[model samples]
Target: MISAVFWDFGGVFTGSPFHLDDYARSLGTTNERLLEHVFGRYEANGDHPWHRLERGEGTLAEALEAADESCRADGIEGFSAEGFFKAMSGTSSEERRDKVMAKVSELNDAAIRQAIITNNAKEFGDIWRSLIPVDELFEAVIDSSAVGIRKPDSAIYRLALERLEVSRPETSVFLDDFEPNVAAARNLGMHGILVGEDIVPALRELDRILGNDGV
Candidate 1:
């Protein structure tokens, strides 16, 4: 009885938001340190600089400055968002997510509607959009920056379902790499899949949920 499928763009369809390991190595740091300094407690939608950026409250430049400040405070410096994102984006392109793309095709063919809900910065829109055939692959693309509402905040989830005109939230499935986001969706009564480093298991779970009923 699933009516639609909701996807997260970053981890679900493409590589992680950035090239963590490479970027970290370039800075003579560990991936964990880089993520902590840059992203800062991502599981929660807090007052962190990156969180504020995704919520459209600040510019990418401001967020990077915050990262640099935090690094300098800890006596660890030389973290530049511009440089890191540039290097990371260099590796991004279409076909990076063929498995998910195929499943999306199958769902599209079955007439099961799909949309993308991403916690993203406004500045990243053009870069990421070009990496995916968003218009062709999804009926709706929801970005937190554009909408002024980020994930783990039920308002955005409600907004997406509203746009999709879904009467029963439980009849939709949402997939994301972040557990908190997925958990929030489940709390709102949707079937949620937590995508991990391995994409196949998550896709398998989606297949099991949708079955062959074709909506």
Candidate 2:
């Protein structure tokens, strides 16, 4: 049985911030390449400006400046971090979010542990919280900015498991839109589910994994 459920706030609960791929295409590059320039190789921890912002080591202005410079150097024109963020939707689908919330509530009622592990910025804290009943829904939220570390880094995952008191990593499950983050959790022995553009299928998989199917 799954003892705990870990969630990624951005893509799981809300529309993915990653859909800004249009900007990548506009600059004649794939989203993956542009994202590497912005977010760095997400699988490894590094000093990328965005990474620093998420780690609370730098301000948004600084990160954006550095990222803009990187884009300029790469000839990716008209790079606007502000605009990219604007396209990051807060909620996926109202009904879909409600479904996930209901599941969370059900798990909470059953005494199954829950926590949010999001690679987010300090600047957007209040804004993100306003999108959901975070405190009511989650026992703990490990925001990378607050903790000085981000996902795909083993330390952060370990920290979440520690806080959740999940002694057996295999008994825990992680859900995220980013595959690398999911892979990282899987590497740590937790079951990881990758959420795509549509989250309904992923939700069904979650139920299947927890044996909450057909309920």
Candidate 3:
């Protein structure tokens, strides 16, 4: 019996606010090369500045300075990490997805636990936090910056399960837009749902997995 539901913020909750291609275009470089320059070899999980920033080891300004230097070394002349993040933040829509929130409310009413698991930047916490009613809709909000660990890491998943008081992974369902994150959750024995452009199908699938449409 699934007793808990885990949600990913950013892409899963709202329209994706950042695009590599768009960022690359703005910087006059190819997406692959730009990503290599900014994210280093491991991208999300490596010892790069981005990873450091997400883990709360450094300030946003320090990370931006590092990225700016990297861009300069790559011949991108004048790249500003602050500008990049500002543009990325601008892409978010203020309108919440009523349908998904309604489903969340239904699940809450069913007495199933819900929590948010996000690998997000520390500075953007207020912006993303405002997008949802954390107190009313979720029982826990585990953020990578606050916890010092991100998704695709088993420890974070374990942390969420622990906080949710779920002793077995099978008693929970996880939803994320990123395939790697979803796969990681599945590996830990939780039923994983990949939320894409349209969330209705995924929510419906979750409802089915929980054995009730009312959920």
TM agreement with the true structure for every prediction = 0.89, 0.91, 0.85
User: In terms of TM-score, how similar is model 1 to the real structure?
Assistant: 0.89
Per-residue CA lDDT of model 2 for 59-139, tens digit only, reads 988988887888889888887866667656533678768878998999999889999999999999999899789999999
To one decimal, what is the Cα RMSD in angstroms of model 1 from the true structure?
A: 2.2
Model 3 lDDT tens row, 77-165: 65776667665565555444666788889989889999999887889888877877877899999998999997788899999999999
Question: Which prediction has the highest lDDT against the true structure?
Answer: 2
- Mark the 10 consecutive residues where model 1 has the least summed lDDT: 87-96
> Which pairs of residues collide in model 1?
none
Model 2 stretches astray by more than 4 angstroms: 212-215
**Which prediction has more favorable TM-score, 2 or 3?**
2
For model 1, residues 82-185, the per-residue Cα lDDT tens digits are 77776666554456488888999989998889999999999889987876689999999889999988998999899999989998999999999888999999
Q: At residue 206, what lDDT does model 2 achieve? A: 88
Which 10 successive residues of model 3 have the least lDDT summed?
A: 87-96
lDDT value, candidate 2, whole model: 0.86
